[model samples]
Target: MATPLENGFSAPALRLHALDSEDLALLSAHVQDALVRVGDIAYLPAKRRFALVGSRFDWTAEMEGRLERCRAGLHFESVQRVRCARVSRDEPDAILELLAVTFEAGPEPPGGVIRLTFAGGAAICLDVECVEAQLCDIGPRWKTAARPTHELSSSESGAP
Candidate 1:
């Protein structure tokens, strides 16, 4: 089998869209450990959009003895409203580590709540008309020594 690089495949900047639950899951995986400053988040009521910029861990690139992170932008369209919990607006400089993105359907079809969960019990919920979101790598990547890790819960470890 030809190596990925040998086959002329190169790591390119990510530009992805999420139109449904499955797509959102993939997008979430790419941004699993992104670090976002509270000040970077914005909700444009006039445009019906919610956006944020973050330093996203580059999971696609080869480690090559070092980790990497790059600036990324994520946005959701047709957003009706935004609600946050455990994320204080008073602390603009505070950084939050993104954990996952999930969707919960509303009573009406094609409408739902998109939740962005972060470390320290912080979360942002977007009331959206549909699953319409985009994630793009917006800048050059740099090397990093730190890799994010998640501790498994007792139930997840199959232990009593």
Candidate 2:
């Protein structure tokens, strides 16, 4: 329904054509006049610089750290268009946390993910083209509920 940027991240810098409401609300609450989130780090890949998102933002050694975390031999492919249910209470929140990190909305160690939560009393989990994460990267990040990510039909999931 609502988009990520439309909901809040509509700024000129980050082209958030679509935004999740929960993320928008969290960011909105934590934002300040200067726009430096206490712990949220943003890396401008083009400039090779890193800065906090909401206030007191500055170019720290953060971007370098983020760059280091990219998976070995990992190359950027097409972005995933995923949708899942919010089956478990914790699923949606977890998925959002991971998405934020991967999308440059949060810390870097949390990056590399593709997931969705289907919500309606019970939630289902769905993930497409994703990097190896979880177990190794653990925290409050959410996951799609009971439903495991459906694999792409041999054809659709592989290509752009």
User: Top TM-score: which candidate number?
Assistant: 1
lDDT of 2 at 53: 26
Q: Give the poorly placed runs of model 1, Cα more than 4 Å off.
A: 1-10, 62-66, 151-160
RMSD in angstroms, all models? 6.3, 18.6
Candidate 2 off by > 4 Å:
1-43, 47-147, 157-160
lDDT (tens digit, per residue) of candidate 1 on 15-133: 99999999999999999999999999999999999999999987766454436788899999999988888888899999998988888889996899999988767788999999999
- Can you write out model 2's per-residue Cα lDDT over 1-160, one digit (the tens) per residue? 2112222321112212123334433332221112212134323344432323222111121232211011011112223333334323343223211212223222433332332211122211222232322211111111111221233233322211
Error of 2 at 81 (Å): 20
**Clash pairs for candidate 1:** none
Find the 10 residues in a row with the least total lDDT in model 1: 151-160
